[model samples]
Target chain A: MSNVLANILGASPVMPLEKHIDVACRCAEQLAPLFAAANRGDWGAAEKAAADIEALEHEADDLKKEIRLHLPKSLFMPVPRQDLLELLLVQDRIANRARDIAGLVMIRRIQMPASIADDFLDFVDRVIDAAKQARKSVRELDELFTAGFRGAEVDLVAGMIEELDRIETDTDARQFELGKALFEIEATLNPVDAVFLHRVIELTGDVADMAERVGRRLELLLSD
Target chain B: MEAQIVYIGLAAAFGLFMAWGIGANDVANAMATSVGSKALTIKQAILVAAVFEFLGAVLAGGAVTSTIRKGIVDADLLSGSPELLVYGMLASLLAAGTWLLIASHRGWPVSTTHSIVGAIVGFAAVGIGMEAVKWDQVGTIVASWVVSPLTAGFIAFLLYQSVLWLVLQHEDPLARAKRWVPVYIFFAAFTITLVTILKGLKHVGLEISVRDSYLLAVAIATGIAAVGAYFIRQIEPDPKAEKEQHFHTVERVFGVLMVITACSMAFAHGSNDVANAIGPLAAVVSVAHTGAVSAQSALPLWVLMLGGMGIVIGLASFGRHVIATVGRKITQLTPSRGFAAELAAATTIVIASGTGLPVSTTHTLVGAVLGVGLARGIEAIDLRVVARVFVSWVVTIPAGAILAILFFFVFKSVLP
Candidate 1:
């Protein structure tokens, strides 16, 4: 690297993790508008929200890249590099899943049925909440780091992970209910639409599941 | 065996080069936040640093600027062979200065204090004997490396909590800021000046008794508080900014305090680091003039001036990169947080300088910033940078020692 670029490259590894978490949180935020717009059959609005999610996911990718590129080979990290990179991958996956769902929605123009509209929206809302919970937990890395991931901070994050699991489970149950409701009406609807709707429902649930995985990745980091 | 103009000239040149490097790299740590946070523009920061650093070295550098590395090497060992000590001093300075420049070029993070100490120990062990290197004093300095930073951390933590309570969390933040900010300013001013008066400038001919120093400390504190209050009074409350961040008004209250602490930090650094550059230079001058190395002697004013001027010139020329690294790395500093970090760092440096202890001001500052991050702002800091810094701290001493060992033999063979 050139001298001017070298300083900038080696310089700001300080808070890229937090910056990454922020991008994750912002990407999670796009889910509500994306779904709400799809519910109204506003393809333009849904596509716009999906585009926003794509942009945020790209930002999170760049921050992760900056972090990886600048991470010195001889650092004395309290948490190992492999664990941090694992955490980054898992955290980035939350944004990735959200983008995936948004991309599917924009691509298929999946229309929301009146029967499952409220319940499906609630499922997406809970998934976004889980993603946010993961962001909040990741943010505690600083305190956990300063505390060396022990004592009260560990307990606090452990509690956050437990709550995230609960939220994810609750979201899972909601997805199942929405799925049941979709199936009940499946025979009366177009067969192709039923298949596509089921696929979209599973992908949306995957967003929350991936967020919970981010939390578990931290648990492994702390315990290890 | 005439050690004439040549020896003294070599010492002065190396000494000036070492001083320039410190001003460029180490001293920038003092004013970094003020420059980084835009509290002081680059030109303005450099000007402020130049003036106060000059004042600090002239007024307070004497006690510390002896012809030795704070007695780390036993000077008595070299009395029988004064010329060897001269060559050792010259070699130590060159080795340390060369290591610093190389480290900077390679983007290695290391402390100048560590560089000089390691160089002195390496040369002493080779030139005189291993016994001539004062392990007891070296032990105390090594222990202090841990003690001083923890002390600064504890100080910063308390300051952060107090600032949080006084203005950040209070219902009426403006009233609290207007009422309490100047008091904190007074506290910082009084403590630093008290240390300076009691400990730093004894050789400047004003040996005020401890009682008089206390009186002076109090008088200066109250005067500073009064002027600071006048400045605080003019800052009308902006409710919009307060609504934007409940902590905004509180941060504003700390703006003046941060600038004050920054100047104190620069002053403290000047009092301490100028000595490192000029100590060996002073020995070379003494040996060349008197044809013998006295175990101890007075530090000439001209030597102090050379150390001070070299630092200033270095800061003017090449201190920007060091300043940028310090100002922008580690953590994002708000004015209040910067105030706490600098205040704690200044306190540590002042206390260390007063009693003649060698410590890295940057390490203490980093620890203070770490302390703040531990309290409630950890998310803002980059743990990776802190880790890299720790690795650098571990590497510098051994690296400097090894390099000095190599250079000491080369200097011995080459120099007459």
Candidate 2:
């Protein structure tokens, strides 16, 4: 039977948006394994990690596109449709950065200098943590929508975004320290190796930057 | 006398057809939220709808029936020739049923209330004269068509906002829900019961004073609340589920409340909508039995029972599938949100019924859902569909009018 009431409730993008961030987070999570395998000189395992990140990134891209397709302009949502699309774009980039960093490290077979190896790995973990934090924050989209982006739910998501900003800031500091360490060892290593290592550090740092942007987009939705 | 029997038979048949259409289609909107939210399974929803819809029609449908039977048409003008009233009522029923069939086939968002009202006005104004149609009463009904939805929407917005403030937004939402859900239950139950006792029971031969009505409504509501609280206390929080979605157990608490609202929704729908089917039949029966258009005659109890029986039969035969399909499509309306819309719509429609206004239940519900959406409760609503509903609202009246005018002319020429 043709039911106006059923048809009136367009497909909700909240759960799908939540699931999209989940996939993006999973893609960024592979970075931890890629670095761990690389530090042990296990090229085979590192290649597998890179491939896994690539696959997850592709999954995230598909989900992002599907969400966009369903979220037509005709939908009347609590938040602006454009705001949600922007949030989706920032979320997708987390996976994009993860894949990019993995590709750069794998193709160049770049090895960290012994002095900065531990510090660099710690830096990678911190950046991954930022993406995880973004995921944690985005996961609250359902609750945020439920509360109409006001009152206690807004405060709760604000706290999450605050913690995400702190993680991103810590990643920035780690990136600065790693850059300085690499600068000191430039003459000892091959010139090309030194340049590519710096590029990888910058690209790895961009993951945290993108994760922080996800928080920014979500914050825009929280406002009246 | 033989022709009188013919007129009554034709009127009853057309009336049953109209009631069947309502049960087959409109009832789905009334019960879908409960099933969609998993607050009541399909079987339970059907049972609740059948029982409560019948009660609403037999006990509370009198006022709107009177409005439809005598309020729209100027029966005084047709008192000298009562056959004209019978033919007009019969023609209006046929026009509405035919229009509903065509509209449903084409998947248009048409309201049965709009169709019947339009057909009645069409036949009276065109077949008789403009003065034969009560323009002031028609104006009031048309105004109500616009006003009811807005009122339901406003109530829904406030109700959902209260839910957010008093329960969902609290840090310990589960505890707050347990503490406050029964109070909401009491309110929902109280409003529907109070209105029915004060306005509906009079036709059923029970003249409850205003003071006693309040006492009775409160007693019934309190008992329902106590039972609801017992159910809420039984729901233990699943820590595993709560870790993923914080409101897991809290929604369960709301589910108990949704069941109560669903019943009210069905009752309200029956109270208002059953009149669309039986009002014309009542007019035809009264005219045929008296051989005069006597507006003062009481509506036969059997006619109300017939309308109720026809609706239940329609539900058993067809509405169950419609309910299932609609329920599956609207799973986005979880118990917490569904209850708000249902309660708001039920309150608005029940009050309208008490006031003898026949408002569209679907339109009222659509308004309530929009109200919740305004409060940011629903995830998404298709504005395009809403626009289409508005378009149909304006179109159905004219369409029903034109069809009714045609049928009136044919009945005038053919019927004795």
Candidate 3:
């Protein structure tokens, strides 16, 4: 019988629940490198980091399944098993989103718009900062849940969200300006480059949005 | 014994229904601003209001209810005719409920409390004499209709302006303003608690000495303000020159203050408005059981509990629509602006309740929204909708009284 099948009958697992959380954290760590590579404009490094994120996502998923299977029968589990499961899923989403952004960047192979590049970079930096806070807060979940943090983490995440919203609004205006500028140069530049540039600019906003969503979900978990 | 029990039971049931309606309708007055701002979802807002409202209701004694029943209406004239008293009580309930239902269905936000007051006036005028009603108290209630909203509007305007000037207008590098946002929030929260407890919980029947109450209020307020100031001063200035971060932080803090303010309003509302549901029932109970109206009739504990529970159920089931109408339909609300409106409305109503003045929550919130709307621009006021709501307010009382009288006569004839 497979070890998984044996474990179903209540045998001790090879990798414990703590290992799964560690694996999830590792996946989140891998994502940070991918985001860094993208920020540095290193296509090759970004592609490699994206692959690492995907592998980590798979590992995290399998661990989550194992945790779920053991949850009902296990004599003891950390916090409500549902909360841990939700935390894992939120972490997985962050990694998957990082991978998705990497894929968009690689597939388009388009140049970033100079006018909005600084704004986009600032948004990404804020997202990373929120993500780092979420990770630190989650690690101290016991303290957060037992002693009320007075929703500090939630407030922090919400602040990041408001910032993301402002950035999106600014990006919308910048995109319109860039689109008009690109249209004026339509005769000189290839139509494909223009299309790719537009997609990349839009994806940048989406990536920031996804990161903010993860921050919000993590904040909810801490507060709940 | 049987007659007394039946009257009490009837009062309990009717009071429960009225409490449910109050919970269903009035909670929106507090929560609308938060929900409109998208600071909290409709579901989250209702849940929080329901819990705090229940806490406020159960912990607080029903001094406010007694005040409404005896202080506003002359029970001396109401003595000696159980049949007429029963008829009057039933008439008022039917009148208030019918008007509220019609107004709610039409999506016009109207005051259930105001409707009840009007129905009481109508029934009292018909049953005894116009002279029997305490015009002095009635005058106070009417004045509150104007006072509450205007006070709330003025406060909201000032609060929003201060927020704009202190936080939104300031140009501080290294996000220095961001650090102070939390301190300002603490002061806002402290003031909200002090005002709410002083104005809202006074009716709860603690009977604390006035000097003691004021001292406690000041102590609580100062303590909170000091702690907030300390933390805000402690936040290390950011290395990045991100002015937007400061603005966003201020906005979020403002939103938090709004939520706390809404919570205070919900608590005070339960203490004061719970009477609208129980007043008639108590009158009915007094008449059916003792065959006389007494100034000091005590409502059964079970009836009060039932009323509180009914409120929770009503809020869970039907409160969302009212909340949406107030939260989203009236106007678009940003966090800072919504906070100002909620704080203003809460402070106004709390003060009114303390001074034994009856105010309309609907009028106060509408005025606050209008104040914010004016700040935005005249075009944002939506004058057509405002006109429709105004017309409903004008018609609500007489319409409710007529409907209640009609319903009472019909039920009386059909039941016998």
Tens-place lDDT per residue, model 3, B93-188, is 767877776776766667877888888877776556777678887887877787777887788777665655455434441243455445555555
Worst 10 residues of 3 chain A by lDDT: A1-10
- Model 2 agreement with the true structure over B1-416: per-residue lDDT tens digits: 99999999999999999999999999999999999889999899999999999989877899999999999999999988888888889999999999999999999999999999999999999989999999999999999999999999999999999999998887778888999999999999999999999999998899988999999999999999999999999999988766433687888899999999999999999999999999999999999999999989999988998899888988888999999999999987888899999999999999999999999999999999999999889899999999999999999999989998998889888999
lDDT of 3: 0.60
Q: Estimate, for each residue in A13-55, the C-alpha lDDT of model 3 and write its tens digit.
A: 2234335445544554554565556657887887887677678
lDDT agreement of model 2 with the native? 0.92
Which segments of candidate 2 are over 4 A away from where they belong? none
Each prediction's TM-score versus the true structure:
0.75, 0.96, 0.60
Sort by TM-score, best first: what order? Answer: 2, 1, 3
User: How good is model 3 by TM-score?
Assistant: 0.60
User: How many Å off is the CA of B126 in candidate 2?
Assistant: 0.8
| Winner by DockQ between candidate 3 and candidate 2 | 2
Candidate 1 per-residue C-alpha lDDT over A72-96 given as tens digits, one digit per residue, 9 for 90 to 100: 6643344666778888888888788
The whole-model C-alpha lDDT of candidate 1 against the native structure comes to 0.77
- Model 2's CAPRI class is medium
Give the RMSD in angstroms, all C-alphas superposed, for model 2. Answer: 1.9
Q: Which stretches of candidate 1 lie over 4 Å from their true place?
A: A1-109, A112-188, A191-224, B1-3, B67-70, B73-81, B130-139, B164-179, B233-245, B295-297, B373-377, B380-416
